[model samples]
Target: MTAPHDVPDLTGSGEYLVPDVLQPGLTLVLVGTAPSGISARARAYYANPENKFWRTLHAVGLTPRQLVPQEYATLPQYGLGLTDVAKRHSGVDAALPGEAWRPDELRRKVEHYRPRIVAFTSKRGASETLGVPTGKLPYGPQPQPLDWPAETELWVLPSTSPLGHNHFRLEPWQALGDRVRELRGAAEAGNPSPETPVL
Candidate 1:
């Protein structure tokens, strides 16, 4: 794992707009379908100012303060990280080729990193990873771990994209923060938080 102060190389194929910000021991990892066109050009995740990813993180108390998209690399310090299902491409989910959704790659990363929680920023991401239709995914913790290791949990959150504005709700994000806090509290108390919800 890269040290917190060391800049980890996130670069990949030319198709990759922005490199993935990932490492081991993350408390949470947010997966998206792909980068927005603007984000691709800007070399940042959720670079569009309109995207709610950064704002929601702060609002949910997941971060100490609101962070701009350019600050993504600093996430690991707070036990948070970012990645996408389609690392070799950038565009809206509907425009991407079916093969672009590489769930196995995501699984390998999660298994290697072993984060406490893995949350999909959009149902499409979760569906692609879990091999289920988006309609079947509910917002918040998922009961099944899919192919994830038993030590990790899964969560599905509504898309923060402007296109998903109709379904946007902050409740699930807040719940996620609460669960993280619960896990931290349990760990600090030297008790196992086995039943902590993935939400």
Candidate 2:
């Protein structure tokens, strides 16, 4: 197997990061607040082996195949895109210490990309980045979708953080996966897909 890469420091860096392996007009875009320990080392957001991302997508039918860590960037081929709320890496999400992600940049991404869905990997990302209240924000299109938003669906599911509710990733994953299914349908129909996975 190939080795993972290390995360670059967030301090004093200037870059307008877009979703990893995002295809123009992709169906869904997965977001995180920033890189995690595993992702930082792997140089791919959500590259952690323990992360249920691919398995959940497979279960929900977004991906017709399985993927190892290095293949994460290839997710867009299966109609998925990866990105972070904050483009920097701070080893752990908790290490973020505060609102490390910028809402303006995220809004800009949404407006520019106009992805069908925007899903946050964790509630922290949604709360810290998106204007959502924390803790289990639900499993469908947000009740109050943004007007200045990218016309993409927004959602805030449970945190995929290893430090989060360690035992219940699958349940939330399944629910989120179901939502993804709906978004994919919209994408296939050329309608506004209403689901975006956020970190």
Candidate 3:
């Protein structure tokens, strides 16, 4: 069946937050496949009460130790920017069937933003987007670099969402935060990463 081409109502969905561009000091551009209802309503990424994104990022040190969702906008100040492949929201990613996978858009963003690292927040998103078999993927660092423009680095991160948990726990997220801070620091130094990093 041809799905209806209707824009989902975001009036109460969490807000969609995209920085004017990407933050300059970004060694990491945290890109999700899209937003969910809670995040749309909260106007923040992973705003669902159970979603552990900010908590994980903070735990990892990518964010400045804050617990409130409203503070999410400030992540760019720390050299992290937020975005998504699909701007619309569905309660679950599986519901977003046939959502166009635009690697070109991703590539364009990489070229434009020039972040040191581009991390995909969910393995499902990365797997679906890149067409990699689920079994062959690695933990933490990806086997190969991201195929984005301008030679951006890529890393596949374990998703912080409760639903996205393939395995592991909060400890790994803390490590991600530290990695983000390190890359942000590196980008600030002008020695950008050689590969497109996705998490």
Candidate 4:
């Protein structure tokens, strides 16, 4: 299926495969490499039925309940947000064009929104953003990149995409959920949470 031409990119870069669901002051923001063909056609993040993204959010306690991809716009109410490194592309990672991955754009968004935590749904996205080789990127929290805001934390999670079955592991996702809850709790109590250690 082709990406819908009617959707406009607010950033003026071009048409977005799936409009980003984001806002300032979110507790967490999940970043992906790009929308899959199915997601682009649906104009929703992780719209494929086989994709575990939505279910994992609830299973890991990031959301109160499992959310359909169509309900993505409501994530801010739950202190969650979403975006992709390749806004104009829609396909599997291997098929994406080199120019489509704009790590700087993602950095600007994260710096502006100031979410408490930013987790990459796949190592490829994180690797591109951090300029590290995928083989060197480990799961869970990572060291702060140079010039990254100290208040915001970075994490790497296994891809929820069906194609990522070989690399998928529930443990890292669970750890991320637990850490998000901790940060939320600390914020609710008006206490400063300690920095999350790299896992």
Off by over 4 Å in 4: 1-14
What would the per-residue lDDT of candidate 3 be over residues 59-147, giving only the tens digit for each residue? Answer: 66676685566676676677777667666544677777665454455555566667766777877667765678657666455654455
For candidate 4, write residues 80-180 as lDDT tens digits.
Answer: 98999999888999989899998877777776668889999999999888999999989999988886878899999999999998889999999999898
* Candidate 1 wrongly placed segments (more than 4 Å): 1-15
- Tell me the deviation in Å of residue 38 in model 3: 1.4
Model 4, position 111: C-alpha lDDT score: 68
Q: Return the top candidate by TM-score.
A: 4
User: Candidate 1, after superposition: displacement of residue 111 in Å?
Assistant: 1.0
lDDT for each residue of candidate 1 in 77-135, tens digit (9 for 90 to 100): 88888989888778888999988888877777777777889999999999988888888
Rank candidates, TM-score, best first.
4, 1, 2, 3
Q: Which ten residues in a row have the lowest lDDT in candidate 4?
A: 1-10
Better of 1 and 2 by TM-score: 1
**Candidate 2 residue runs with Cα over 4 Å from true position:** 1-19, 97-99, 145-147, 165-169, 186-199
Relative to the unseen true structure, what is the C-alpha lDDT of residue 179 in candidate 1, on a scale of 0 to 100?
87
lDDT of 2 by residue, 1-199 (tens): 1111122322223452323444457767877777766666666555777776666667666678767757776776777777777775455666775546676656655666667678777776777665666754664446545555535667655665556647445665566667667766775799864535433
